[model samples]
Target: MSEKKTINDAVSKRYEHGFVSDVAADTFAPGLNEDVIRRLSAVKNEPEFMLNWRLKAYRKWCTMKMKTWASLNIEPIDYQAISYYSAPKTQDGPKSLDEVDPELLRTYDRLGIPLYEQKMLAGVAVDAVFDSVSIATTFKDKLKEAGVIFCSFSEALQEHPELVEKYMGTVIPVGDNFFACLNSAVFTDGSFVYVPRGVKCPMELSTYFRINAANTGQFERTLIIAEPGASVSYLEGCTAPMRDENQLHAAVVELVALPDSNIKYSTVQNWYPGDENGKGGIYNFVTKRAVAHERAKVSWTQIETGSAITWKYPSVTLRGDDSVGEFYSVALTSNCQQADTGTKMIHLGKRTKSTIISKGISAMKGQNNYRGRVKVGPMAEGARNYTQCDSLLLSDTCGAHTFPYVDVANATAKVEHEASTSKIADEQLFYLGQRGIREEEAVSLVVNGFCREVFDQLPMEFAVEAQKLLEISLEDSIG
Candidate 1:
């Protein structure tokens, strides 16, 4: 009905991997043990306090069990069969663009990330994590100028021990969930960001993650803290080369927005999805959340179009009066892919408000589900929430579902939810065909329109690239 939708209808084509490279990998052997964890920590040169923290997490994880409650039917994961760490051996750490590896820069260029270290050296900052280690971090001095701390988690633990000790596992406790516990124990590398009180980050903070080693699992943990009156926007990108064996990728991300502070986190995940038969792909199980302290706000926007099995739910807790939480997501599951993803909003403060918008596209035997919850505590007077979830199935072999749980203890709370499932109409494609657009291009346009609502929330540069990635990834199923 809308002009944007018309354009999206033309862009609903299926996708496939565009660029495959022949880069060599530097890796550790497959396995998990105290020795492995210790080796990883030693490689990072972590402080004693941090090593003890990791050891504690490892002990807790050893006693935990793997989660098996989702509708997915995945094979049992073998921890010992996965390499805990990997990196590219060709590149030594570079302080500037000229000193960086040309091959590495080419890879980012193919992935469509703007990796001009000069621009970053001039203003923007980046933490580029390849496999298990952070290769380089740009614009460190500039961020420090504004009292912002942006560096790898390992570096943060050593340079800012007090800050790391105080905030680590504070938002998402170590025992929060199964995968989270695993991440706490063995996460090899991730970014850490802290914005000082009353200071807005002068430039955007971002991390680009790539999985290069075969049989290696990627477990990265990201923690961000915004002090009172501080503001920051963070972006993350993921990509892995094509492989037959399913690789495990479990990650945890936590954000804490203190009083009067605001944090916006965005992600564009393009992991390698298996072929139509589901033979080889990544199993992406992630837990991400944010807590908005009194009078604070946090927003999460994600575009997911990868993985053979994806199970994720990014949630927010509103503990501050008048604080707000928002989630916008576009998830696509094609071929034999399965995705069970959504969000949760817990209203604990007066006048707290939350919004959720989820769009799912399923094609060729794909299965998609949106499971979410909105809870208004007894003391949350005048709380409000709104949710919208829609699914588009490209063929009869695909399926879509929605499960929403609303718990309202206060009578004054306002809650609303709407869900629908539909398929692209033949007439719509025919209309586009009549206008001289090819069938594939027409399909891409339509699907893009369907996802505009969520894509619009992405940064300007990422939004355009995500749209193109969606179009390329769905190329095979459009017809």
Candidate 2:
């Protein structure tokens, strides 16, 4: 086949996860108000304190305006037109996988995530969130044996109120940003994890988020805390059904790594980027931050390949001596998609360190930008930071840009930044073609090689999946 024809054929493939699941849902009216928050809190059976907190966040959000970024051109969101809560009508707090609805299980099965423990990946616990509620959590008993607490946010609030109240907004405060504040007021469900002191979680932990309802926004809150000498790794994935009208997904994630502890958080975001003309898709806006104490470590790795418009910056705050933070990411945008994503590192203690590595690939009119910041405080003596950003453009219509911000308040701090932009040159393609390589496969190989550094940081199993996703996202950009 001609190279152009091959590109067109590949790009025409539909998003595999775009089909909607037909399940009855108890949905709220399309509007936002104090009453809606109260109803949401009441439905969840939350305590008085939780209700008060949501009220406070909601009031603040009412007075706040959405912050505008120079690099992002997003349409004005009609908050009153979005349903803030949607849950499976039959959900009654399933005690086990079997108690969950069969249709919900089938939905996950179609998404390649098995809820049944025996049929799922070994040593990996999963929490499946459909719409705005957590449908099921697998391997709870196994996780409990190791003194770990892994369950839905609502469950954590009901079972461990003190812990939930203590660490919920400590990392990302209630009024951190507009979307986060909105989430704080009406978040229906998400995952909560706690690793006890001196205990390392026995297996990998994951959460899969699916937005199956139309005109209903999904707001979920996740909190993870690692006590001293504890360690854990967590993963998150997201998807949404294809629709002609854009949907909203605003989430918040907070990680607290106490002294001598370690935490790793990764995300695989595939939220159904709109069709070639960008008629519809999810508007993904999220806030994620981690606080690392003395001698602690926190790392964030992500593979972002979907969403019509993405605005996110997962960050880390080094708050104790000898603390370390790392951010690794690979973002792919194609077919009218736009992405503005990166990380932030704040060094506040002596001898703190941080590293950032980012890769961006743009094809077929996709626009990708990386904006990051590295800061060293006056007390952060001997602190260090290194940042590297690379962008690859697969077609003449696509564009990539980078913005780096650095602030050094300590003379002893050492910070280095490096960036490069490149295109898939015809000469390089010819070099591979001369060796009998097909144009499509050659493009995939080159793109994968360009992204290997970031992919290597993903878990072994996820790395392979990420490579395949990258290949599929690039199939239409060869022209």
Candidate 3:
């Protein structure tokens, strides 16, 4: 117990990336209407079809009510008070890191984001999004040689509208949910990737999102399409400066894997959580989904440690025979943070299979909820699914809940679920302290040991980063 309190003190420091940047920005008035949608479309110089799509989404969003059935306690949001769009006033928009504004480059550099071209040669291609626009993209020429299209969503809209039009809204339609509809209406910019048939991407594709301006809602939409026999891996990371008022973030991500292809997507979300009193932070409501065609596979791995309130469910659909889907996640909530997140797997074709593993950690007055669903359709003969959910509590004031739903329409289908809840006992900490390990090291060791199952599924680089993130997020809970 002594070591546990010491370790909690180490983790309770303020957020690392809480410094706001000062840069000239072009921002829209705090309001939403058809005019705002059209003006945003004009700013992007989108095609007529794109403009029509946004309008349709706006009309639908206006009629639908935000669902609050999840185990999250979020205050009502005032859409009219949020600036729908905010972008840096860059002259002609910099095409590369050198041409980018020095202030913006410094912002990313301070955040430890690699924006320099030399980093591209080390097998990482990055697209950096600041506020509402993409400021720089590295290694475009190298990816072009292999018929891979990796750039900002805006670039995809301009250069490859046909591709975007074909896949956009296919996996999760505009009316699928309330937040998704809102995102489709006002989304500014995000990353887009296309891997051609039979070609494995040469390097890992990544995107880093930074929310700089205050009172601005970030609505970035990401779409990735992998052709038949192609494969790719993608990474997404985000952070926001500290502020006194809660900021709203609604984003959508879609993935499409054709026959015999594979896609692996990973995220490390470190959005700012409010102070101990929960006075300020971000309301992160996001929708992420993927579709797996015949013999294709899609895997989602995420580690979330910030945000005042988070409600998300990354899901997958097995649409063709023998397709596979997977979801692995580790979510930690400390202080007054609240999170209700999990995944859904829908098996539609024959012999489909899916695996889900989730780990939730809560401390102080935080709340963590895991809600998941698995459905095997009538045509999905021989479908199989396995789900495991585990929760760890560091303080008696915190709470953890789990809700798992399973539906099997065919007799040949099989489904299984397991759940466990545990608290950090004094004896465990005492046992570790007797081994001569430092308090922080002991805490990290215990936390890592608990999450080893999900960590093994992450990429080599991402695994290390996630372990460190877990240690940092839990540092202050005990003190």
- Residue-level lDDT of model 3, residues 1-479, one tens digit each, is 46446545544557889999888999999999999999999999999999999999999999999997898887889999999999999877786677888899889988888698775338889999999999998989999999999999998999999999999999989988999999999999999999999999998899999999999999999999999999999999999999989999999999999999999999999999988898899999999999999999999998988889988899999999999999999998888999999999999989999999999988878899998999999999999999999998877788999989898899999999999999876677778889886566666677788889988988776788788777644445544
What does candidate 2 score in Cα RMSD to the true structure? 1.8
TM-score of 1: 0.92
TM-score of each: 0.92, 0.97, 0.97
Q: Per-residue lDDT of 306-369 in model 1, one digit per residue for the tens?
A: 8889999999999989999999999988778899999999999999999999999887778898
| Clashing residue pairs for model 2 | none
Q: How badly does each model clash, as a count of residue pairs?
A: 28, 0, 5
Can you rank all candidates by TM-score, best first?
Answer: 3, 2, 1
Could you give me the TM-score of model 3 versus the true structure? 0.97
Residue 347 in model 1: lDDT: 95
Which lDDT value does model 3 have at 251? 95
Off by over 4 Å in 2: 1-13, 473-479
What residue runs in model 1 are displaced by over 4 Å at the alpha carbon?
1-26, 90-93, 97-99, 119-124, 472-479
- What are the clashing pairs of model 3? 8-475, 8-476, 11-475, 11-476, 12-476
